[model samples]
Target: MLTIGKLGQAAGVKVPTIRYYEQIGLLPEAERSAGNQRLYSRKALDRLTFVRHARELGFTLDAIRDLLSLSDHPDQPCAAADAIAKAQLAEIEKRLARLASLKVELKRMVAQCAGGSIADCRVIEVLGNHSLCAAEHGPRESEGDS
Candidate 1:
């Protein structure tokens, strides 16, 4: 059995994140050592690795939880998993669209700058007046990404 620290090291996740996963039920409650430190098995290490990979792929905790549940029941059909992946793909596409729009607006903001005083700065001018922006992105910065 590996200690929590070792497990975290092997899984490329922080110790606190591992603890948080445990607290959130993404990871199983770890067994304790003689001094009450958390001890983990190889299975725990593998699970942590899976979680880290999913997180790197931008899977939310709830999605990861569902994927884990599906993992636990291997006999279940893969429709749910495929649906989750499709949803994630759709989210990614939305983010890409938002990013592309942001890029255009930013480019316009930069290109319009004549390098004069702040009062005449195109960057500040566009920023102060959202109406000047070409993209119709919403007020919140996290609208489409979420």
Candidate 2:
């Protein structure tokens, strides 16, 4: 049996995260010792490790839950898991494209800067007037926020 801290260390997860997973039903509740402290079995350690690995791969908590549910039923097909991985890949590709555009815009802004005072700063001017920006940065999430 492993204490919560030991289980966290073994699984490469933090203690609070393990506790949260238990609360959220990702991990089963650990048995308690005579002193009322949590004690984890090897199964808990393995489950925590799986959860940590999924998180490191950028799976959202909801998707992780789905994957876990699928994993519990050994006879089930893996189409759902495949779909989740494909969706993650598509999201990554979209982010990469956005980041590339952002890089181009930043480079243009930096290249146009003449090291002048703020009154004549190209960077400041471009930032103040979005129309002056060379690339189209799509509407930000907080666009409607004052």
Distance from true location, Cα of 91 in model 1, Å:
0.6
Report how far off residue 66 is in candidate 1 (Å). 0.4
Question: What is the C-alpha lDDT profile of model 1 across 1-146, one tens digit per residue?
Answer: 99878888999999999999999888989999889999998888888899999999899999999999999999999999999989998988888888899899999999999999999999999999978989998666566443
What's the C-alpha lDDT at position 90 in model 2? 81
Best of the candidates, lDDT: 1
What is the lDDT of every predicted structure here? 0.90, 0.85
What are the per-model numbers of colliding residue pairs? 0, 0
- By TM-score, the best candidate is 1
> What tens-digit string does per-residue lDDT give for candidate 2 at 1-146?
99999999999999999999999988877899999999999987887888899898778888889888888897989999999989988866766777788788888888988998999888888889988877776767323311
Report the poorest 10 consecutive residues by lDDT, candidate 2.
137-146
- Model 1, CA-based lDDT: 0.90
Q: List the residue pairs that clash in candidate 2.
A: none
Model 2 C-alpha lDDT versus the unseen true structure: 0.85
